[model samples]
Target: MVAEKITQCMKPHGEEGYQTIENMNENHKEISDFAFECVNVGENDKILDIGCGGGVNIEKFLKLTSGNVDGLDYSGVSVNASIRQNQNAVESGRCNVIQADVSDMPIDDESYDLVSAFETIYFWPDIANTFKEVSRIIKPQGQFMIAQGTDGNHPDDELWLSTVEGMSVYTADELEKYLLNAGFKSVKSFKKENDYILIVIAKK
Candidate 1:
């Protein structure tokens, strides 16, 4: 029953799912901040945040750039929550939140200066292919940033893996290999001291 509940993190829906997103927004903040520090955000750089969840990160991105920020999530509940969180940006045409899968996005080719995935890729299917899709939407010399709470070496990794359905964790090395295979020109990774936080940046 606990594992089933945990599965809500995969494709959140309903009230429980909504609550899960809210919790994640708060829980993932520190790791997200670490990620922000590793990437450069230009005032006019457009950004697309995958698995935008409650849209808290989108709110932060709006402050960092004068250009638009968009969000994509497969969960409709998450989409609604994100839209609500960034309602003003949406109203002013500064943001668009779409409910769509990572493997097949509706964005135009080379559309963004930066693409980010935060605490979300563990639930992705065929991750390498998804990276290709991410690459497709990023402009040349643009970047893809991935932030995770684990590098597959956390103390509770096994427990979470056993409990959450379809969830997987990868080390920085493994992820780097996949990113390179997906056509990224270069990849750099950072790990927090004495912590499980991992940030990987891939340039196209």
Candidate 2:
């Protein structure tokens, strides 16, 4: 029963999922902020947040960039929450929340200046191919940033893996390899001091 609730982190659904997303927004703030500090955000840079649960990060991006800030999530519930969280931006034509999968995003080629994945990607199907899809949508020389609470060495890693269905964790080395193979030119990773937080930035 507990495991089922944990699975909602992959693709949130109904009422329980809604609560999970809200919790994620609050819980993930620090890591998200750390990620932002690591990357450069231009005043007019277009941005996309993949697995943009509850749209908290989207709201953050809106403040950093004058260009459109879009969000994509596979879960309908998440999409709705994101839209609600950024309603003013959406209504003002500065934001768009889309329901889509990472492996096959419907966005146009070379559309964004920055693409970010936060506290997500453990549940991605075919991660290598999905990275390629991310590459396809980013403008040349644009960047991709990934931030999560684990570097795959956390004390509770095994417990979470066992508890959450289809969840997987990747080390910084593994992520760098995948990003490079998927066409990123260079990859740099940062680990928070005395913490498990991992942030990787890949340039295309």
Candidate 2, residue 55: how far the Cα is off, in Å: 0.4
Residue pairs in collision within model 1: none
Clashing pairs in 2: none
Estimate every model's Cα lDDT from 0 to 1. Answer: 0.94, 0.94
Give the per-residue lDDT of model 2 (tens digit) for 1-204.
443536788889999999999999989988998898888999999999999999999999999999999999999999999999999999999999999989999989999999999988898999999999999999999999999999999999998898887799999999999999999999999998899999999999
lDDT of 1 at 163: 81
Predicted structure 1: clash tally: 0
TM-score per prediction, in order, is 0.97, 0.97
C-alpha positional error of residue 5 in candidate 1 after TM-score superposition, expressed in Å: 6.0
Off by over 4 Å in 2: 1-5
User: For model 2, how big is the CA root-mean-square deviation?
Assistant: 1.5
Q: List ranges where model 1 is wrong by over 4 Å.
A: 1-5
Question: How much is the lDDT of residue 70 in candidate 1?
Answer: 96
